[model samples]
Target chain A: MGDIDIANDTVSADVVAKFDLPAYLHSQQAIVASHLESALEPRYPERLFESMWYSLSSDGKRLRPILCLAGCSLSGGDPELAIPTACALEMLHVASLIHDDLPAMDDDDYRRGKPANHKVFGEGIALLAGDALLAYALEFILLNTRQVPAERLLRVMHTLINRVGISGLVGGQAVDIECEGREDIDLETVEFIHTRKTGSLIDAAMVTGATLAGADDDTIARLSRYARKVGVAFQIVDDVLDVIGTRQELGKTPNKDEKSRKATYPRLFGVDGSMQRARELVDSAKKEIAPFGQPAVPLLAMAEFVCTRTS
Target chain B: MGDIDIANDTVSADVVAKFDLPAYLHSQQAIVASHLESALEPRYPERLFESMWYSLSSDGKRLRPILCLAGCSLSGGDPELAIPTACALEMLHVASLIHDDLPAMDDDDYRRGKPANHKVFGEGIALLAGDALLAYALEFILLNTRQVPAERLLRVMHTLINRVGISGLVGGQAVDIECEGREDIDLETVEFIHTRKTGSLIDAAMVTGATLAGADDDTIARLSRYARKVGVAFQIVDDVLDVIGTRQELGKTPNKDEKSRKATYPRLFGVDGSMQRARELVDSAKKEIAPFGQPAVPLLAMAEFVCTRTS
Candidate 1:
């Protein structure tokens, strides 16, 4: 309970100050990254393993996996049980990034201030790397997390696949691409694109951790609410950053959405309106965590941190 | 077991043999394709769904899923229990195909004599379609497969994901791409490439089905061997067909492997030698099933059928 108070106060303050999220996220990132490296070692053609590890180890915010760990911890499960699944989330996210950087998708040759996967590895290897990452992510979840109940594991699997699947993230991406350069795209269309493109995986990450902890249906539902709010808020922040932040800060080439003429929050809602929406969503997400008492404080603070940021 | 005999003998041989595998494959292909359609129904601009579905449902072999169902039956489980998992396998397989047809990968302009996914649906939708199929496949397995225990389900998951992951299909693909035009590449490299590229998923299909049916470890091992042999034989036949089969008969662009200067069985082993190896591997694979007695007949026959086919 005391941890909750400290996290709530300190976390929001730190975020407002733009305190180092990487530093905040570093130790766990190392842990998850190492686990991923170790998980992939038994396989062959060591170069391929190196390629995957190199792509993952590249600098970025470890938000999804960290959220997964937080979700599991909030549900009173050992973070270790969440480790593999958390890694899986990271891997899946990485896969999306790899594909997203291709010439046909974003056409950007740079990622994380360096050449994109396709640029450095060539389009063929880049494609294979993405496929490998996705396949391995599921493998990691299934093979690790040995202690989680089978039903719970199955639920995690379902959540993961559904979120990443066509109806969710993939479906969203397709529409986002199609809607590009189209002037008449509406709010509903934008919402559909963002929800599936980013929201589904983020929602999966939060709920998957709790599910692994054997959280009951009600708790699971609440956790999902928290995840949805945070997920949307995260994307809003992303859009805002594209409009306001620099490439050095954000890691990839900036203003991509605008340049691509893709629909964005700022285009749909003024910057201030989007900011307000993000804050409100974060608050709603925090409220969903109230029933968890103290254990969920991290999640709550994380939500607040999501919106109260500059970059 | 007696039912097996009845199915083989009493079932109209004409229907089974004269049955155009490619034609039959697409008829039920819609069932798996519909699964993707239903999942994405709620999206805005429903046109996105319509186009994505149009691309995926166009046509496919549906081999992996059918193999999964057949494998389950051979291991003494109801084919029905394997449906969801079969769907997953198909989704995963479809995902690979979608990506393979992309300009970044195989650079093909057509598949099944239709416009490629990227060409008709555009690159963004094509990428999304692949991702959607992959995710949907995993979800289908988790949600569907009710008869199996959780442990069995986990095993099935482990098999599927691992086979599809970097060390399996993806890894093989990377190596194959790297090996292109390397006339110096030897037989070991060729074997490594093919084994992981094709063998892993085939192994997963059979092993997962058997694991669900609670086959003993020994039986599981035998099934794996059977799958590996058939997978390699199938690949060899594919290589052979690339040289000899007609475009109309095979329903795909032929002789492209040689044109691409890709390493293949016919290139490494003379045509006659490749055919001989296919027979040997098939025979050995059938022997692995010898202990399963008559119940394993379909599996054994499938192994022979794999090598015997011209296409």
Candidate 2:
């Protein structure tokens, strides 16, 4: 049976559990990762290609791209048609990570299980590689995606640009970098950084997928609200994990946020309070998707999974 | 008369001289510059906004964007309609300059008679500022542009991404950085670097204008040829300037390329030979546009202008 049919079935708990969200997410991740593998067949300067793919081939949670694909599937749109868009989201994420890990930015030496791109390729190549990925992400969608109408593609294009560009991703990153080592950062500053840097892409991914699936304005607005909650919750949990989580569990640096004096939710709110906020966000996010009913079952499960991943 | 009508005038050398190209270029530059001034209006963080505009408001020639507007006007399209696309080209160019001037890249201290972005801001803030400009360029076009058809806008978007992304700007930057201080680099390597790094944006600027004006494939191909020749000539002129040019003229460091052991045309061919070669490229570039007859006058003058510019 199709995944949707399995999603629709309210049979025994055993069948219901068989069609669990984790399995769905796993298959989606593999599909997106596999597509991402060939997404960058760069021309000259083999090192540029190497630096770009190094971080991309790592073992991070395919959260944003899967959310895009989930958004598409939930709208009864062809998920296959959304895969290139999915790949684009993942590529943009990698681009941001490559830049963020530079000695000038986050200054981390390790990402995933390997040395950071800058550590392996040097800082200059890493910076250029990040730029390449960012530019190629948009081009890949334009050249590779098929069976989607031009209007939908245009909407998707605008959505990605706003999310990753100045209005969203870059703006937040600037504020985060500026706020580093400052002890007097307020709640407003923390919220601004998290929403722009972390929340923008998540919101864009869901909205882009919904747009590609021919979603209306109301549906898109609801997904935007839902995505903001999920994104803020994700960042709060991330702050908590960085403070107390281990390398084996997080797969990268830990407690670095605290060391950097970054304005984080966990710092502003205590760990217990942060966890409470995440759960509350998850509940509200699920409520936003309530009108979608059964199709949103997986989406609701996603929020729950996000709220208490390792607790 | 419309700009194209004046372009078609060929009564006398005096009239041709009277209807000069500089006046047209000046007006176009003013419009593009004015639009670019308010192109970025960041909401929350003021520092980010300041860092972004610092490089943008400098006293550069504004060549690429003016070329875009000129191309649109030459095609009988509304120059006013091309302003947003023109602004985007300038923004992307500024983004490249910001990143390229970083300590890890060219490591230049000066740009446009002032300190480079990284020299003015810290390394981290400079990097983020560049990212902000790059992202904002795309967003600005998607958000602010009007009256252009969706297909044309899509075409313009694709062109910018390809020109600025891996296959173009970022790829060449990686190679240029890698080849620096290496004696084994050959003429082919120089061609690859200059064409991708410098020529890509020039080509994109011309193609974008013509595409916005709905020019035919034949016309676009001719403009592409024109752009390549002019781009190479510009790079050759740049190489000569670096060796024997001044801070007052170039507005940045001189002789740094030689210090880095860069593969420059003037280094391979003597300075006089490189100048001769530049004139030849300019001559051939003007010839490609000769088929357009009277409407190609400004373009021909532009080639002549490129061949001999002291300051």
Candidate 3:
């Protein structure tokens, strides 16, 4: 409470002028990347270690982790205290990616410009490594998060459970997989995937950050709306990017959703229409968090950035 | 501490005589099955619900769940209190089996006398359903388990983490998968898979039950040893049954391990020798729990059953 003051939400004029999202994201990603290295120790069964680390260590935007830290910072929580949980979120992300990219799933050959984990570690190790990461991510939070109250951790677990379990990410992924080659998929079906699959985790990231900081219910609710809207916007933009962004820009294979005949925003709405929808969502998300004023700067900028950003 | 007394450890002579393990297991399995029917209420997207429940509802000996209940009973804890965690353990086991039988993993077409989840549900749904179960199992414990303290629940999660993560079940499964099709696979490799893969869950089951019931450290350690020994013995007997029992008897494919060239105790030790080793393990495990006297009878009987029992 001492850390969070109305004054803290008001930025000095000079400080406001110097704020830069790319620079902020770069610093946040660095923090998350370094913390991630320590989060997963390479033990015996070197293959599991190597397989898990390969995708983890590979370069990515670190968006979810950054979002988590950003939310914590905005809530006036000690950002440092959120590192373990932040890393856990990233680890879970990597695990989902690893499994999603397996031969049986999306069957992608490349991720972040590297041969997919299974392409290098073999399918069995890749799949098991994903399983290990998913389970270990939860365990890491249980074992490593400190200063946060136990109930907060339980809230975090609850957040993760809803986001990761059948009601959320898994369900979204199932629908996405099920939608493959079905051209009749409506806006509801695409929204089904966008809102649940990728959206749940992003929404959880914000709630987790706010929860860790012990923010008021009002703040948490606002952030949830902000995150939910922004998450779907992010996915909508992702679909647009796949159609227009290059492999170098996306840092992986592009147009894969189209190639798989998977239902996507671009397929349903067209690129321009999807981009328009994204901007609308981001605008809505920004309004939701506007009450925080200066403290909301990063989240607002993140929403705006999600509108047209490549990769 | 108050519940555990000298008298609590004494088994009534008639209770010992009427133990009737098969009957006992039958009754316990019935309890588990009924609880499981409600453990996961099917929800739509209907495919995900269908895929998850297909394997979960399949008939098999509810060994781990029963072990958990038994441990709670031995400690004079309300057996009902252990049900949630027991169901969680079973859910996790089913998840492992679902992932294990995938085309990318074990490639099995049948499990528990029915088509494997992957075979029936498609690889993607089976995989996601497994992932859903794994995450949901943890959430279910947190959501259910009426009287357990938070710290105790945390302990249950901690047990699951160590037992099911990379160091335990998934790690063992990875090694087992890796060891497939290799002529030079050693006894140590076989032991590695046996102890870590199947053994970890069994070991955790007992510990979870004990932990839920507030068993002392000594009892937990002894139960762990008992479970470890019995798990390997169970696998050995399973391998023996695979070689000797018909499909009608085993209720699933038999001799599949030999077909895959996977190493087993029988391949390393002759059938007679494997049988002897299982007996020795059961004997040693029984000795480890010998101090518990009457309280250990069910576990003891379980050990002997693992020694020579066929499917």
Candidate 4:
């Protein structure tokens, strides 16, 4: 690839208007899926790998990884350089899902239109599978990522780990679990939970990609802000879907938030109000990356997709 | 510190004879403890941090981190340089223990003479705490490790993650769980479980330290072989203690392996036979690292400690 100065790289309005988001998503999803398949081949202690792959292979929107690649491409870096990190993001996301569906946690029996990991592999293996995936994600990134400077890769590893730890997803989930069935939860508390629980990984995905691509600090910061807005909007849409969508459309049990007495965006704001909020966030997310022009098309479209996804 | 070529560094018999193993262990343990204490400070989302710190602060041998430092020191590197990775090793070890004690896993109600994590913090929070610790261990290494080349740090990360994932602890745990009550489990299978479940992280600890210290490939290989033997011996000692040691001495339930019908060294061979095997392995471990002479005192002493410890 030619050394394109990403700071000054721009495309005409006609080129930006011609972008096809669905095609972009489809192609990126295919690339991510292929890599994910080979990223963790089943090995000895076959059952454990089986359990890990079960959740990993189940169909879901490969949003985080796709966003990671998009961030790399937007910064004029080779998208291939970000593929391993992208795969790592998906592994982490699936791992969180498996653990979240455990009996002591959300206790859901289904995920992505299939039996949950624990339901099929039993809780013990399911839990270990989740643990394996979490650890392996880092291993995969370190082993497979090529041509990237070691310093940048270390930064990527640091970002991903930070987002997964107490300051981010774990802390958010703890508060969410603690506040379940409590009527005292406020909008601020809900936002706190959503931002960390869901938003942290989403932000990490973009930031890691940009950092790996050697994007300037300002560009990384812009992408991070864009991710933060979209992440919140994504969670709001999920809450709304859980309240209104069917099991078929949602792929898991619907109305679970109500059943668990969990506080949500729709609980505080009406469904219409929640949708309006998501729309506003999506618009703001797009605005955050507007300076990147045509290169930002995939990210802007993803933000819209997050606001509108049924499952 | 003056630059000493580790390959040529040696001590006379008089100095080696005067080395106080107990004092070395005590000092190293104290150093590791202090670092671990500051490694994870309590933060907001008070309950989550509380749960994490509760298990982490619970007293244990701190053996893994000490071994890491010993490996670094043996290679003529500053022990301080290895401290962060050493603490990461301990964190990873503690995280595994927390998860292992869960109801869905080992169902243990006690650990280190106190209620197990799940017993005190509910299964959900305990699980999350384990997850947080696992993720934070990597984060701590990346953020705290200094003066090491980024390539070495990445290699350390790769080594740690590889051991924690399916090929190591998780895979071993899975097989152990699967073979819980099976009479068909053979000596080879038992060794497989013990080696990976207990040995993998032990191997990672030493390897990470040596790698960070820029140990030669041959030196790393010797240390690795030393760790493998010591790790197996360590687990055998643990199994023997479960059979004969009191709860006060073991700091947990005794004979729980018999209760669970988990295959173990003592179960296959009597306690006498198990102890003999451990002694043999410890001797072999010492032989592997004998070339390092006086610098190998700590590691050699630790192997002996592993074979002889009551708990």
Candidate 5:
């Protein structure tokens, strides 16, 4: 049976009970969420800060930064060492969302069931706010931060930038834009676009967390594999939900992928095949965590959660 | 009479005879130029790198980075230690120029008498190239290939990011955009725009050079004063040139400022008053260096050069 099916049975309850994770998860959320808010406190232009904070404050799973923390924890390193870097990833994610919502791109009037940034902040300010957030994200990684080796810090920056740059997020975005209105897309194209659009930074986030904690090369390599599988599964689930989910459940417009005629797993592979592929990817991601044993439980659970999430 | 007038009539040959620069400058330029080229090499898309490098390699005075090197030399630091950072600033400058040239801002189709980045590279590529350059610039600093002291390396990054953030370059750009098309901008508004836009990075570059070399706070402060004077003077000359410079000499369309009716010193102060203020600023800038005596000769000459340059 798929992990999602198992999760719907008694196994998930046992996993949660065994881990005793509610308090830990809530505590981590509070800390991570507060750090994200504080990291975004604007030193100038109150409106820009308000706009950025407004979007960031909106409801969503704090998935990536928490995964960064989890990756650090799994490697026996302090999550505190990776907090700013994690926040940086969150900031970058928000920037992409803001830009993706532009009239020229996805043209979405709503995000998370609320008016999009461009809708409320004015297109120009929203555009600049995204740019400011991106620039500030890098600044957060490189400046006013505590101890990490200079060379390692350099690596952190290099990895983040590379993941966020053309070969990663932006390049994926270009292809995604081009993909709009096209009916012909294969699995490879979907994978290529998703890998860059989502996978690169997700990969960067987990790897950065581990690296910041001084994890060994092999451990980092494994974490990268885990992140990649999870990333792909995450995107697939998102695509599936857009086809099946209600607007209220998803907290945004439903069926956008279908309505836009955007290439997606459901459109390309049929619903069952898309579901099978997601499960396989999740299994592969879990396998990468096998050596980490119990310490890897959270990551594995997170991956399952990503694939099975209703919204 | 202007410094150029004096140079042509009385001191051109004698100045050249007495103050010929060492061969190190040529070597430094070659090394820095190579690092610059290598930094922007394309990865995913072949055309991306070429588009980025084209503007960066365009002929113009690389005054800010060169000033960084000179400050490093004056502080008795290894010039090589300053080289990558020097290149980083140039990259940053190029990034700013790309963004500034967008249709939303200066709207210049031509820069340095050639098609602007948006005109040549397309807007999407131009935006990504600028973003990539900034990311790479910070990465270069953190890499610190020269083995700068850990504390010093941290300081250099702190200075650069702080000066480049909203309170500095980005903030300056926002204000400049706001000031555009306004006919009644105050002196304070103009000063705020110029100081943050041009002055902060220049000051950071010089002060960072000294701070890296272990210069005391007082000396770094003095260097800052020198940079501020020259930076403001440079902008004033740019403003003056917009009114009087020929297309060939300016290497850009000279009549845009007037045609657009952008706020400028020449527009506000008239030709003669703006020139007078620039000269006064240059004198005050020179006075800031009086304590350094002959050691500041190069900096003084640079100040004069800023005021006199047609382009």
Candidate 6:
């Protein structure tokens, strides 16, 4: 709290003292969870919806959606205006997770401490549910976003799709798949995979939120840089957690990355070195938005939270 | 050609005589193919793009994109304005095909006289390629569309996504999978499945084209009705061909649906009866758009093409 006040001169010490990051994250998470719950009501073809909801409702941190809302607020826009886009971000995240856990992909049996989507619904329905969720995320944003210009909405859509398409998340996953079980994987290759696989969507989440809130290009760019740092840091922490934490603590199988021989930050740098790198990234991420002062409090805290979080 | 002149009082006999359906289809298909060829350039992660392009460039009728362009032309908009969207429709169609051929779904080994996507590229890359194409379709539309108002583009996106999401293509597919091998499946369930699985995307193609061209509500609705009829008829013809055609002509294994004990139009109705039903649908589809006069000539010819097509 003292560091935040010292970093942003425009943020008063009193406000810093009163701000609670956990409470803010919890409240924002609740809002996103509620919106997601009401977004899809069970209809005909109950099985598909059931499978979709099963993965969507899993107990996990709603990190991407929370970042989106925080991005909106940091840009001096009403957080309420970003709810639909927030939910859409989570939907895309869950869709990717469901597909990633398939037998043909990562073959993970557990996710967030629950059976993988295919394990419960079988592979066919799980695949269709993922496809449905991807399309529905776009539909939900187009139909539900309000009080924003059409141009802004289109920009948000463009950013979201671009980050998720071939040049971003999908591209990263493809390269990662190709590199599996290879002994020649380097730090640069690992960074490339993590940057696009995890970092690109995080960039989209923040950039889209700020875009929706009418943030100028400079502000959006700054937030993007901030997000990139935090994104990589977040993944590094995940790697460290995977090596050092248990299934009960991480809500996933521990040491699975080692078993698969997948390249990870901890694998190359060891847990202590990787954690030190994550701290440096979080520090740089906070500095990127220091000029925004009071408006960026939540985002600054979120950057810190990335390296500190256990799961 | 004679029936076309008789069906529309506003179309002159001279115009009907000059309108060659095959030549027109060939020209439009060439244009769509050219556009699609240029849309995706080879980039990094060469294997992924190779897999995506392999399926996208397969030999098939460019029916959906042609319908979209025709829809735009019918609404008096420059067909060029709808070219990006036309390409996007084809991308979505190809993406669905790739997924539908997966081992967990249809388990198809051949498509369009060649190996299925998963057969050529492993199932994981095939799945990711499908995901990339789906997302790229949205990104392509947002990036390439010009000379259209942002509001109309949003509406078009909404319609495309809605039809492709639950209660449309995905919902239809879910039910189809569930009803497979069940003898008690009735005509109503089959219609319900076909309407969503096949009909919805076709409806989206035409309706989105009209919407982008500034068609009135009534005209868009009329075109949707026309699309729904042709879509069902198109599936019926596919069913008939599955029963009566060979692998050489169909470009896939014949009678696979029957082998799987899946319900189909020809399964419920004899091949002749299904063909007869398709003819009736084509006739009614033409009636729905006849009021558009000479502007609907391409679509009118397309309606006839749907039933008469041998592949």
Report lDDT per candidate.
0.75, 0.83, 0.85, 0.88, 0.75, 0.88
Per-residue lDDT over A1-311 for candidate 1, one digit per residue giving the tens place of the 0 to 100 score: 11233224322334324534446568777887777667766456666666676678787667889888888887767888999988889888888888888887777776777778887778877877888888888877776678777877888887888787666777677777778898887888877877877888888988898888776677678778888878888888899998988988877888888888888888889789999999999888877776555565566667777887766
Which pairs clash in model 4?
none
Stretches off by above 4 angstroms in model 1 are A1-27, A33-39, A291-293, B1-61
lDDT of 4 at A273: 98
Local accuracy of candidate 3 as per-residue lDDT tens digits, B74-140 = 7667989899888988899999999999877888888898888988888889999999999988888
In lDDT terms, how accurate is model 5?
0.75
Locate the minimum summed-lDDT window of 10 residues in model 5 chain A.
A1-10
Q: Alpha-carbon error at B159 in model 5, in Å?
A: 2.4
- CAPRI quality level assigned to candidate 5 from its DockQ score: acceptable
lDDT of 6 by residue, A1-311 (tens): 01223233555445544679899989988999899989998888999999999998998788899999988888878989999999999889889989988988888889998889999999999999999999989899988999999999999999999988888888988888888898788998898888888998899999988998898778889899999999999989999999989999977778988888888998899999999999999888887887778887888777877877887
Candidate achieving the largest lDDT: 4
Candidate 1 per-residue C-alpha lDDT over B1-311 given as tens digits, one digit per residue, 9 for 90 to 100: 12232223322233335445555445445555565445444454465455556655655566676677667777788867877877677667667767777776667776766777778777777777777666666776776668788878888888888777776777777777777777777888888777887788788888887787777777678789988988888888888988898887676778888887788999988789999999999878876765555556555656667777766
Model 1 in CAPRI terms: which quality?
medium
Question: TM-score per candidate, in order?
Answer: 0.88, 0.94, 0.95, 0.96, 0.86, 0.95
Better of 2 and 6 by DockQ: 6
Model 2: clashing residue pairs? none
- Please write out the lDDT profile of model 2 over residues A55-109, one tens digit for every residue: 7788878889999988887777888888888888988988999899898888988
For model 4, how does the per-residue alpha-carbon lDDT over A1-311 read when each residue is reduced to its tens digit? 23335466444544544677789888999999999989887688999989999999999889899989988998888999999999999999999999989999888998999999999999999999999999999988988999998998889999999999898888898899999889888999999999998999899999998988898888889899999999999999999999999999988999999999897999999899999999999989887887677778778767777876777
Q: Sorted by lDDT, highest first, which candidate order results?
A: 4, 6, 3, 2, 5, 1
Best prediction by DockQ = 4
* Model 5 alpha-carbon miss at residue B31, Å: 4.8
Please give the distance, in angstroms, between residue B68's alpha carbon in candidate 4 and its true position after superposition. Answer: 0.6
* lDDT of candidate 4 over B11-30, digit per residue (tens): 45445446777898889889
